[model samples]
Target: MSEQQKGPAGGGPGGQRPGGPAPGNFGFGPGRGGPGAMGMPVQKAKDFKGTLRRLTGYLRPYRFSLLIVILTAVLSTVFSIVGPKIMGKATTKLFEGLMGKIKGTPGAKIDFHYIWEILAVLGILYIISALFSYIQQYVMAGVAQKTVYGLRKDVNEKLARLPLKFFDSRTHGEILSRAVNDVDNISGTLQQSLTQIITSVVTLIGVVVMMLTISPLMTLISIVTLPLSFVAIKMIAKRSQLYFKGQQKALGELNGHVEEMYTGHNIVKAFGHERKSVDKFNSVNEELYQSGWRAQFVSGMIMPIMGFIGNIGYVLVSVAGGILVLHKTITIGDVQAFISYSRQFTMPITQTAQIANILQSTVASAERIFELLDEKEEVPEAATPIAVVQKESEAVPGKAIKARGDVSFNHVQFRYKEDTSLIEDMDIHVHSGQTIAIVGPTGAGKTTLINLLMRFYEINNGSITIDGVGITQLKRGDLRNLFGMVLQDTWLFNGTIRDNIAYGRTGATEEEVVAAARAAYADHFIRTLPEGYDTVLNEEASNISQGQKQLLTIARAILANPTILILDEATSSVDTRTEIHIQRAMNELMQGRTSFVIAHRLSTIRDADLILVMNHGTVIEQGTHEELLAAGGFYADLYESQFSSRKRQVDAV
Candidate 1:
């Protein structure tokens, strides 16, 4: 019989004229670089270097902590680096003692005490290294968490400030991915990868220095193998990167499909689309499997190829050191240390390569976050806004102004886009406590009128006034507080029934909440539930029936006690009996408050003081129900058609 629509309203249909876009078509367009293109899209940062520079701003506050982490990482690497060379001394000592014993030299017995001393020094060095590593890790974790905390806070605040239009064109899932997953990526990198990079670089440098001290020729041989390692990594990475991109794109598509199917499963079942949904899922899944498999296989080649090249260098170094030892050019201890340093050298290079890839991914995540933050925010509110305060009887001096129920729209014009005309030269005036009912066909600008009154979308021209003061001059919060709205599509969050009702008014007393529920004819049914007022609704509020949910929303609006009431098919969900009871209660509630009732059922609004018949975002007729009937106009025909249909139905029965 009636329908209530809510959320961001846009300009007229097809950019023709007046009323803006239809209500509740919060669509998801391929935004910016969103993946609707033909290829497997790689999720790379649009501005990698610029994003990194911007990312440093988040870390700037933790600069001192980062500096300490760097110093400790260096210390940890230095201590760990010195251990191999020192242990080589013990190795050389043991080797020399064995050689001396075989040669029958005097004092040829192994020096166990000297070896023990070297082991003790080595143990102390390792313990200190571990301690420094632990300290750096602990400090870095705090810095990382705190940095992300600030980032998440900024994102949350930004979401609040964003206009309804921003949400209208985007999916909830896409926005959430940027907010949750992307931020988590940045946090992980800051916590672990950042410190690892520092340690790896320091170790790489220390190993190079140590190797040079041992044998320049061996170091040269080891260094020469690095080019081969680079070549292998570059080739594998280049090939695997495409597959990685494909894998990511497939994964994203799979996730989006799952989210859609799960949320709309009831609709899918109603339409017997289960097989089709499964087929779609399987197709995406197979694509993901192929790409993921190829990516992993190609990426897996890097380590083995690098290892093979490294072994070749190791063999070359070993042979060169052996010849040098025969000539007494370098001690065997130096050869042992050099070998250890060489292994150490390759590890850091490998680690640095891995971290480089991670850094790219992290910067991409940061860029997504920055893109969200950079979106245009809602227009700024009026400066020196008029306060909507309580009005005293007899015009008390120095008291603030209070809003009366009078509302007037003077020659208003609006469009969702500048090129189209949705609402053109629309004018209406309502006195205090008048019950105005809007009757119209679909896309008739019925909801748009309510939206403009609520200031959900700003009008392009003319002015709307309440109590002789411009609505734009009033604080948005204050202006909105003047009206109470109840829609056909009821919304309730996961909370106790009492809490949901009390949401209409902050700090409301328990008695007031119960009284409002009673007025809405919801108290009796609510008390029958297991937990009564304390009953918790699920996320979708599917635990309760539709009519009961509508009743709860009605109760909420009643509790708000706003100056003006806007009921858009508020009683559409209830049964005939419940609707009668609610209508009686609403009559009592609207006694002195201005009310705007939008409905398609002509019979329900017969007693309204004023009825506006609308079509295509413009008012076609305006009069009381009886006045319109006597005039034999558009409203008269609409009213006659409803009764005629009902009469025919009764005759058929």
Candidate 2:
């Protein structure tokens, strides 16, 4: 690939991680920079209200659940308030009753009936508080899970719609992290944190009201620390967001490293690059360690600080309330009630202050997930793409659509990126049943040509047509449905052999799948497996060989029975015996179909009716194998270089 195609920074040899630069990147894991890789900012919380408002839409479908959760929170808070009030009232009644009893008089003469009535009311409040709290916790959990489920589905669908280039630009792990860890953080913390907020506010309100009723002067002095605690809480939250964001980024990096290592471990072993990879990994691991410590350190400070302020509030209320009791500003029971109210009010404040970090981090996570969902797909079809229906006679086994299989590249031009053209001003035509071979060196646009033909990438400045009708005019899926491709990277999903063979023809009978496998010479090894056709093979189709894998892919294509077939580097990764078997299978599969072969194996395509030699985005030579050799052009030169080099090596041996 050219530098222009690669860009200044991309997935070449030196593409950095998502946020860039590991901790020790120079001759080690990172460079002069320490563990601050994501460059996280501790800015004041951005328009959190706006973010909260956006989140409410996720609750629309589960409005009833949301309603129940809200009601529970309110009810739970009311119970919390009643608990302290009940104790205070009963304490007062007990004190008065004791005084009457001490005078050797009937406790009822002092209207103990009123005190008993108040005590009964307190007992009733306690039951209500416990019941509401239990139900409220259950409902909020359901609400959070429901929101997260919908969000996950939305994110997944968005991922499917995005073009292949997006996957190339980002790591698999980063995308997976965005879907999982980030979403989990957003949802898991939401229910608890939101409930805490409600409880805190309610308790504060109830306590303040009760305290004022008893002694307003004492109440005012008690709440002096409340505002300061809130300010400190807010400051800690601001700091916590940076830490959480960094921590999340570090996790993504760690996951990405694991995925890369696992996927490419073979390459590491083969090239003896394991040591370098290990060193890089350890460096990333250590950086995560430091980042994690910092994030936890900041987030953990809120609770203790809020607790300290609550303690101060407690001391002030006690000193002031005692004085009020001594001076008869309030009765002993009233002083007791005021002290209970002060604790209630200050306690929730501390809890809310503690959970503030969880709330902010969730908001940040939601914003990130929304960002991905908001991405625009690269190739969107027209509102109504004209469809091409096939006749019953021409239709493939499972496909209902078919074209004439007559392909034409009309002044065709294509480029992986805009700066370089892989194919330009190319024109070619093939009948319904003809074979063409494309031969080229590395970087000769052979793969790009196939990509254009398959419509994986768009062509520029020209059009490709099937049966004189533009392919773009047809439905995208229908256009692709006419052909089958055997790519260099053969991806076999986790399933039984029969399922993989009949993957394209989903409703095909077992017999048809078996027939296709037999034609590809894959039946022998497949039947030898423990399960035969039912033998499961994701990556561990161990009883079979690489040749068998190639054959199986071919069998799948044959079962698909496409009118057009593309054999792109199909024989590139197998031994000589496997190549011969695959080549034979391919010839059988290609029969009576317009077939295109992209090959480095010149010998295989020697019988092709038309051979095109390509170089640097253009066809350098075109003719039959013999005709091209006689012309003595680029094709001839490539052929001579290959066979002659082989002959010289053999002679030396």
Candidate 3:
């Protein structure tokens, strides 16, 4: 891969986790970098209203559950809000009784019964409030998961439908960041922030109403300081935002540097670049520390400063309430209740401020997800597919019986970009049961030809056909099922060897899997492993040698039993001895089947029925090996060059 294709060292910024203080410590439920996270950089969507509306559509299916969540949240906050006022009545009764008793009045006795009843009522109210809160959380949790489940499912389906160019144009990390990290951001916001926003707003309004009923003058005094809290938050957030962005960027750089260094540590050590690598790591690490701490410090000032301002308001409300009590305008109980309301007032105000930032980031994440979901999918599949017959008499089971591997590309024109042509007026016709070899240098559009053949890309003009039926007339799945491919790079998932091989065919019996392995000369290696066919391949299949992995992929292709075989440098990774054995096995597999062999080693295609020498995406010469050499053309020159290179190697040995 080129440096451009590998992308940056730290993956991408969206994929990195925070490298400093845990976001949860700031009262954010998770490191969502969204609501209630003060220092985290806010990310606003380009189309905030549109993205938010689309995000809301995900919740449409759970409208009933959301209704329940909203009702429960409102009920819970209202119950809790009314508690402080009702308890104040008990306080007033106690105060009046004490004053009477001090004067030695006969009837002046503390009302223990009334006080006890008040306590019981308060406990029940709290219990009901707790129950409603629990119900809200439960219902919202379900709604959040189901909503995201649908969104994730849509993203997954979109990925499969996307053309190869879509993946080629972006880094793997970038795609994964949008699909996984961005989707997770939306999920976290839906699960926690959505409900919290509702409750905070409700609590703020309810607290004000209750406070007003106690003492309007005190309520006014308490709320007058609210703007100070907002101002402090705005000032702090504005200053800290830059550092938070720096912290995120620096963290991504550090992560990418570390990952790149670790993955290529062997090369680094061999080249004695350890010191340089360490110096680079230290540089990025230092940047992360600088930005992280600065963001934390600036954001940390918010709570203390908000508290200081809140304390001033508290002092003012207390003095005002005391004067009112003395003037007999309000009871002592009203003073106590009003003070509680004042304290409660500041919490939601702070929460509201924090949540505003969070919603912006959350909307940004949603916009990214929506962009992916809205990407144009592979040109829609054929609405009415032409059915192809399957015949057991075909050379291989499950082969394309109608075509017998007859393929023709008619005056095909293609270009990856509009400004440059890759393949122009390309034409090829392969007869059934013939071995056709495609020889070309690197970047000569060799792989691109195969990609076009399989419809991984669509041609700009002309058509590809199988047995006179246009390829586009069949469903993509049907078109691809006609051929089997073995490329230089082998791909195998983390699974038992048997399962990986069986992946080529649905419901393939264990007997057929072993037989296919034997045909590819892979059975000997399989039996040598500790668990044989049951041995599980680790991620990357690193437990096996490169040659063995290639053999396994060959076995998978053999099991597919396709009539049109594509061998793209299939034996490039094996030793000469192994290559000879594989060549013989492939020769037998290719009998009565059309095969397209792409190889740089001229010796491998010497026996090909028809050899096409390609250059600059156009075929320079085409003929049988003996006929091509007799013609003394481009094919002859390419073959002679490889032969002379091999003779030199032999002479040196």
Q: Give the best candidate by lDDT.
A: 3
Best by TM-score: 3
The CA lDDT of each predicted structure is: 0.80, 0.72, 0.81
Cα lDDT of model 1 by residue, 1-653, tens digit: 01112242422112112111111101232111111111222346789999999999999999999999999999999999999899989988898899999999998988889999999999999999999999999999999999999999999999877766676677665677677767876887788789989999999989999998888889999999998888887777788768867776776678778878998999999999999999999999999899878877777777778779988988999999999989999888888888888888888887776666667767888898999999988667788875554423233455567656898989899887889888888889999999999998888899888888877778899999987778888776777777777777677777999998898888899999999999888899999999999999997789998878878877887888888888888677789977887787677667788899999788899999899898877888898988999999888888889899999999999
Model 3: lowest-lDDT 10 consecutive positions: 1-10
After TM-score superposition, the amount by which residue 613's alpha carbon in candidate 1 deviates from its true location, in angstroms, is 3.1
Model 2 score (lDDT): 0.72
Instruction: Mark the regions of model 1 whose C-alpha exceeds 4 Å error after superposition.
Output: 1-42, 267-287, 388-397, 641-653
Compared to the true structure, candidate 3 yields what TM-score? 0.92
TM-score between model 1 and native: 0.87
Which 10 consecutive positions of candidate 1 have the poorest summed lDDT? Answer: 17-26
lDDT of 2 by residue, 140-232 (tens): 888788888888999988976775557666775467657775676667566667777877887778778877777888888887877887788
Off by over 4 Å in 2: 1-54, 60-68, 102-120, 126-150, 227-305, 350-356, 385-402, 415-422, 538-544
lDDT of 3 at 196: 88
lDDT of 2 at 312: 85
